[model samples]
Target: MGSGIPVWSDLTISDGLKYISGSYKIAMVYSGDSAPMLVLENKHSYSWDICISASEVSSGVAFYSYDDIAQAFSNYGVS
Candidate 1:
């Protein structure tokens, strides 16, 4: 994984979501499973106004945390 972050490649999206929706901080999202859309955890309060967009071809793992999402947007000056 990039930046030396360990990615659980063995875990499927459903399995990853189970842990992510609970306490797990990160997961690897395969290119095939990712789409051009925002995925927010409804259980947590988030800034609905923030819009971060990326291409479908930018394949990589992503974090589900609000802080991570916000940082990603900030990186692109979208926040």
Candidate 2:
């Protein structure tokens, strides 16, 4: 697998925000006062011949809100 940043398509950011928001809300239903942590992953490489899954790297941030997700994306240059 190659090691580098993944470039997101134009709609990815907006769509990702919606996904995170929805996920958080769903988790809130069961979380009580605890926060739901989202793991941010980026796929850096993939090959059909590898006979395995794509390569991904975690952002190492425990995102708990839309602002945290947005800031992490910006910090990692995901756009």
Candidate 3:
């Protein structure tokens, strides 16, 4: 993995409804297993990809926590 999670990667999140405010992202990934799935990966963390439940999220989409997304990225590029 790299120093930390890259800002380019996508984190999938679903609510079984429309896209949440900040609870998800839009991305593309390959499918596997006996079913279909999304691909959420951070360039920094190439060692492994985070497989999230997509019962609500649309495939190839990245999702973030609507509650903490803004706070989480408060200092993303403040430097």
Candidate 4:
């Protein structure tokens, strides 16, 4: 992560959603699964590839939380 980049893990859900809506990619991954079921891109550029892991929280269906997704972007320098 770059020093100038905003820390995604610190953003609130409301703020995170607003930011990603402008330009970002979203993928829904099942809990414990290794693949994303749906990939959503909103004016986002695929300048680089990113992989996000499952939340690992036991649930009937697992999905990446907003903060988790944001952190992945931050970790990979998506911005």
- Ten-residue region with minimum lDDT total, candidate 4: 2-11
Task: For residue 55, give model 1's deviation from the true position in Å.
Answer: 20
lDDT of each: 0.43, 0.36, 0.39, 0.45
Q: Decide which is better by TM-score, 2 or 4.
A: 4
Question: By the lDDT metric, which is better: model 2 or model 3?
Answer: 3
- lDDT for 53 (candidate 4): 57
Clashing pairs in 2: none
- Which digits, one per residue and each the tens of the lDDT, describe model 1 over residues 1-79? 4234244322124433344333344443545555334444323444444433443233565445545565755665654
10 residues in a row with least lDDT, candidate 1: 3-12
Q: Give the TM-score comparing model 2 with the true structure, all chains together.
A: 0.33
Q: Write the residue-wise lDDT of candidate 2 on 1-79 in tens digits.
A: 2123333322123344455552452111112333323344543442111111112223432224455555556666654
Relative to the unseen true structure, what is the C-alpha lDDT of residue 46 in candidate 3, on a scale of 0 to 100?
A: 62
Give the Å shift of residue 36 in candidate 3.
2.4
Q: Write the candidate numbers in order of decreasing lDDT.
A: 4, 1, 3, 2
Ranking by TM-score: 4, 2, 3, 1
TM per candidate comes to: 0.24, 0.33, 0.27, 0.38
Global Cα RMSD, each model? 10.4, 14.3, 11.9, 12.3
**lDDT over C-alpha atoms for residue 23 of model 2:** 41
Off by over 4 Å in 4: 1-44, 57-60
After TM-score superposition, the amount by which residue 63's alpha carbon in candidate 4 deviates from its true location, in angstroms, is 2.3
Tens-place lDDT digits, model 3, residues 1-79: 1123344564444542355355454333434432234333445556554443334334543333434333333434210
